[model samples]
Target chain A: MTFATRFRKSIEYQVVEELSRSVRWDANRIVVNTDAERLAGVCEALAKAGGIFDSAVLSSPASTRVPQVCYAFRMPDLGLGVSVFARGKNITCLSTRLDAAAWDERKIKDLAGVQLDGLEDARPLLAHPESGWGDFAEAVSKNRQTVLKPSEAYASREYAMEGTGADGEFEIPVGPVHAGIIEPGHFRFFVGGEDIHRMETRMFYLHRGLERQAVGRHVQRILPLIEQVSGDESVANAVAFAQAVEDLEGIRVPERAESLRLVLLELERIYSHLADLGGMATDVGFYASSSQFLLLREEMMRQNAALSGDRFLRGVVSIGGVDRNATQENLDATADALASFSKAFDELESMTLSSSTFLDRVFTTGKVSAFVADELALVGPVARASGKSCDLRRHFPYGAYKKRAVCESMAASGDVLARFNVKANEVKESARLIRSEINQMPSGPTHTGEKRTGHGFGWGWCEAPRGSCSIFVRTDKGRISRLSIRTASFRNWRGLERAVNGNIIPDFPLINKSFNLSYAGTDL
Target chain B: MHELSALLRAPRTDEISEEATDPAIRKVAALLRRRSGGVFSRSIHVRMVDAGSSNDVEVEEGLMNAPQVDCERFGIHFVASPRHADVLLVSGPVTLNMRRALEKTYAAMAEPRAVVAAGDGACTGGLFKHSYAVYKSGRVDEVVPVSVHVPGNPPSPYDLVAGILQAGLALDKKEAAKSGKS
Candidate 1:
């Protein structure tokens, strides 16, 4: 074994020896049960061992047992996941030491009714004050329907954002409904004239209680709901959830299905990134380039509809493997389409890059320093643009990625231009990956028709178009007892806040587009 | 210059033939064009409110602006504010948190405005209907008067355009009813 693998094994041994009540080792994960008091220490030790904080999930309360909280960390070097679970109503907060755990802890507090002893930001995360429903945690625990009072006068809740108190500072509150065709999110900008002094975003206006809705549902039935987590990220999220269920059942996906999935994923990434690239151009008032990008994106969406019967590419990924295999003719057609697409995309890229006006607007605008990116644990293109190599495809290879290495695309500037370059390059890279995956075209049965009945839990993760999307699922007799999803948007929203600080208000939308974090995914 | 030559070589429009266009979109466009001659002067301003959707509806709405569908060609424009809008295109089974916001947006619109509930979630609360977080059925009609329902997992851009045009007809009827009452 390599040194990093040996070091991680040693840390795992130490954690099991010192903190765990019982240890269960699966293929790519280690689940350790520990006390609530020791939760913070376990997380701290894992962090010291160079583990990246992935997500924190809260399981539903059983009749005789309290809800359990599982904190998952990614040991990228070893390609192993460490999940430390503690069953309790009160758990020690790791947010005091780990800034990345702040949002996860707050979400647990809101949904699970759990109290983290030292969580500083006590404001509600998912449950809004103006929602008019009683305490969400109470409603969830009691399994009671939310009582509606439409007669109650409409009221907007106040979000506290202390201004810089400089001579000309004032706050500009923008959306729960924006001026554009986008999801609803409220942005608070404290500005001194045109330049932004501080920026705070209050999201979760789109929370549909997806996790609570998953309870008592069969594992197979939940894929549709998981796909709803984010529209553009349907395949990635579905694949992640399916992988988790597959892990729980210990079913190996057929090699052909794995290759096909890689194709589908790369296609999704291509179209999704096209939208972002187009949006960035639109924000900068460069319609010439934006139109070309959108045109290509439209063609890509049509191609997706042809491959899978859905425009958004939903219902393709199932528990054991993919739902249907693509015929070689279809694969060849897609490869041909990709050839022309690459040509058009290259011209568009050069056209946008060569434009001095476009460059002037995007270059050095909305910069996220490497330190801020690391502190916030940003993922996907956002982290890669900031010089932090956090691509899950490289670090924790899964599915077809284990066989084929990804050519990493990154930039150190972390500006809007750097993000544009990274995302644009990623689209090209995705097209390349798709073409090669099709060329290799593994021929076999696409699924291992295994029974999914089981009583177990497992972690599933995928590098979504935005970033790494990780899901945690626990099943009882093939029914989902508990489900929690931590999308890349949840990890990277804070990075947007940091990127907007000191930048002008007009550039806010540009920066926001550059990150392109999913409000629905984050809210869910 | 290479840039100048590339710009010249680029096609100005996609120029998709009517036969290649989705029949649903063509039918809606024809209906909208005919209706414009009577009441609307061929223009309808719409403001979209995402009360609570998975955002598939939002993506379709954006696509409606793309060159292929080009809802603007049928005199439909997405305005910045509800005050300027002639219709409120709302997607939901409206979440409780967004209920007030949705209502506020509807109230902000001018008179004779129609609402189009786009997507399965908006019309019938689709998958999230049983969830506690949303209003009854997560249906837009539960919160607002939906003049038309365009239901798909998310209604495609063509269906969305059709629904909006149908909403325009509903708005014209509302206008006629109001003038008669006055």
Candidate 2:
């Protein structure tokens, strides 16, 4: 039998097995009620069959009062993802067996009120004690019933230290507000002089109920809102979400739209990654290098504005295809910009690598060990930095990525410098991909005007700048029934906690810049 | 860059000789003199909690150091936080998710406080008033009281400096007002 035939059969067998295991699997989704002990065995079985464990979301169904724990695992060979749902009896904690499952379980415990029976490290993930998890859950659940939807509750109740510390271990509380014009995230540092003993980050200060607001709204409307989730990564998230919806509906986007989508996605990646590289350089006082990056970033933003009308590419991508089709002139302008960006980036890259000060501060700082990275299941550059072989584009091909291979970037150092190097190289690669894709333009409509088939579940994802941004949609007869978007930040935020362990307090910003995760994306 | 050029081209008090001794200019100069201190001691940390606004150009241009009010001299830092802030500069109308963060930020500051409502959105809801995400229509003052209203799509950096200094003055007044009441 052919590989495709074998792959299809494997998926069918997996589905049947899940059905025989539990009656809850009747809905077509793989629902197995295995005990906590069997969780590792299930993961291993799926892994052996070329399945990649994506993310485990801690969510509550709008109707049911009980909390739901869903683990999303992807079978690359079959191009299928099965969401394994295990309800009742939170088996201690799953993190001990599956490292990536640890923090997600903690987050579930904090938000949906599930007790991870044997989970290690049971501290709150996004909320504080003063701001109880039940209160936030109630707020999120109530959003469904309100006229003016009450956004997800954003609060963190302070939790006192459990044990007594040595005298003079003063706490240095930084932000909800900070020194930079960034998002709101509170970092509590237990410091003895400048050395940091423990660093705890409390965010969600600006949790706009993005999912709640998206509830019941047409798929088209949510694209613009998703773009606005983070000012910088608007296009990446939108494309990822749209791809997910399209996958579920089984709608084939026009060849032209798919090609253009690839072009825009790459452009977005280049600009966003450039900003990060520039910001990292600036943070370490490399002004000459930083200034050059700023200039490049400005050029890209102007090109984006001229081509799409909005600098950030907001309101661009839609469900069927893109909202605005790019003319030949716009396409030419973009190609020209990519060429110039390539030449200029070469100079900046050389300067950044050659600079001793830049290398010293960024290298060997903010390290997340290989074992820790596996357990936490970090995504994007963070996951790759720690020598973890993972990339959504390579693991699960979607859009133009499936047709045209992505030259995946990875680093073993797992330091700030390693992240910088990986991103810098990726930026060049993105430019190269954009140039090549545009050169071989496809001829067709940018979108399919047909109505969506709403009786099935759709899943889609894109390799976002921060990490893999995955979206799941369940449509009930042409309307969105349930939607869940697990951004890269949500999965990688825990990696930041682990990275900051041995570093000094002052080095926090540099370490953070390395990961460069979005607070708004995670909070939502 | 075009927006930056547009801001640079605008006439400042230095360009207008007749307004050298004007009260507004005097107020501006007086404010500028005391603006040496910023949100952070090591850096001039300017934390902008943009409520919600459509004028991103004006908002972006307002961040640059214009012909006047060289914030770099004062070591003023432009930050994204409100917790470690010495000043709270608000832009755009207060949106629902952002309302609590704004109010909590104002309350979190130590005693002396100053708030600058930059842009029409922060001063008035402007175009986003009809949107459901907006917390309070009209102004940020509706959600949390304001000390200075720096109105523009986004005010120029000079105007931003003027607003920041005004916030410092308000902080002084707040301390004095507390003393007088005591």
Which stretches in model 2 have alpha-carbon errors above 4 Å? A1-51, A58-61, A66-68, A76-80, A87-93, A109-111, A114-116, A119-134, A144-157, A161-170, B1-45, B50-87, B91-101, B104-139, B147-182
Across residues A76-103, which tens digit of lDDT does each residue of candidate 2 receive? 5555566665565454455676676665
Tens-place lDDT digits, model 1, residues A151-256: 5434356546677788878989999999999999999889988999888899999988888888888898889999999999999999999889988888899999
Give the docking tier of candidate 1: medium
Per-residue C-alpha lDDT of model 2 across residues B1-182, encoded as one tens digit per residue? 32234355554324323246544345556655564453222333456765544324222433343224336554455654555666777765555545666777778665565677887767876544444445646378887778888875435455666676677666666666777899
By DockQ, the best candidate is 1
* Candidate with best TM-score: 1
What TM-score against the true fold does each predicted structure earn? 0.96, 0.77
User: Candidate 1 chain A — worst ten consecutive residues by lDDT sum?
Assistant: A147-156
Evaluate model 1: give its lDDT: 0.86
